[model samples]
Target: DTAVSQTPKYLVTQMGNDKSIKCEQNLGHDTMYWYKQDSKKFLKIMFSYNNKELIINETVPNRFSPKSPDKAHLNLHINSLELGDSAVYFCASSQGGQGGDTQYFGPGTRLTVL
Candidate 1:
């Protein structure tokens, strides 16, 4: 069984469109995060959720939102998507705090905004 899973492995949409990516982890981890990898291959954390506290990266745009209905799930919703929004979005989970725990990553959802 996949420890972490994400839907719509690939997505293509026009600028200004809205999209969402669903993520779930079976590892029973208490912490979940969303990361975005740009074309340059630089990965940056968009949001982190732990113990009901959410930490949002300042660099992330307001158009991006992270929603967690429970500990095992985290979803990314992008509104008014722009060309710069095209990237690989990865969902990850860790056992403990945001620190040293090993994170399991999902396959990733590639979003292309034209």
Candidate 2:
């Protein structure tokens, strides 16, 4: 079984369309996070949840939301998608909500806004 899985690995849509990417982890971790990697391969943390509670919000736009139904699942929703939003969204999990914890990342969902 996959430790971390994400649905719809590739998403192609218009600039104004809304889209969502779902993620699930079987690692039984209590912390999950969402990261965006731009075309230049710059990675940035968008959101993080620990025990189903928001722990980090890195100046992300209001249109971007991260929802964790439980400790093992984290989904990302983007409203009014823009060209800048086109990037690889990665789902990750760690043993706990700590800076030194090793994070396992999903394959990532590539979003393209045309």
Candidate 3:
């Protein structure tokens, strides 16, 4: 069984469009996160959910929203997609919401905005 899974692994859309990516994990982790990998390959945490409570990274834009229905799922919704938003979005999960815990990542969702 896959520890983590994401739907629509690739997304191609025009700017100003809205899109959402769904992620599910069977790892039974307490914390799940949404990370955005920029074109330069810099990965930054956008949001994290611990036990269904959200903790948004301050640097992330208000347009980016993360929702966790339960401990095993985290979904990302992007409003008014921008060209700069094109990057690989990774969904990750860790046993505990702490810095040293191993985070297992799912196959990235590559979003390309034209």
Q: Which candidate achieves the best TM-score against the true structure?
A: 2
lDDT of 1 by residue, 1-114 (tens): 999999989999999999999999999889889999999999988898875568655578889988889899898899999999999999998998656779889999999999
| 17-114 per-residue lDDT for model 3 (tens digits) | 99999999998899999988998999988888889998657488878888888888899999999999999999999998887999999999999999
Would you list the clashing residue pairs of candidate 3? none
Q: Candidate 2: which pairs clash?
A: none
Q: Rank the candidates by lDDT, best first.
A: 2, 3, 1
Give the residue spans of candidate 1 off by over 4 A: none
The candidate that wins on lDDT is 2
* Candidate rank order under TM-score: 2, 3, 1
How many steric overlaps are in each model, in order?
A: 0, 0, 0
TM-score, one value per model: 0.94, 0.97, 0.95
Given candidate 1, what's the lDDT at residue 51? 53
**Model 3: per-residue Cα lDDT at residue 16:** 97
Candidate with the larger lDDT of 1 and 2: 2
- Candidate 3 shows a clash count of 0
The weakest ten consecutive residues by lDDT in model 1 span 50-59
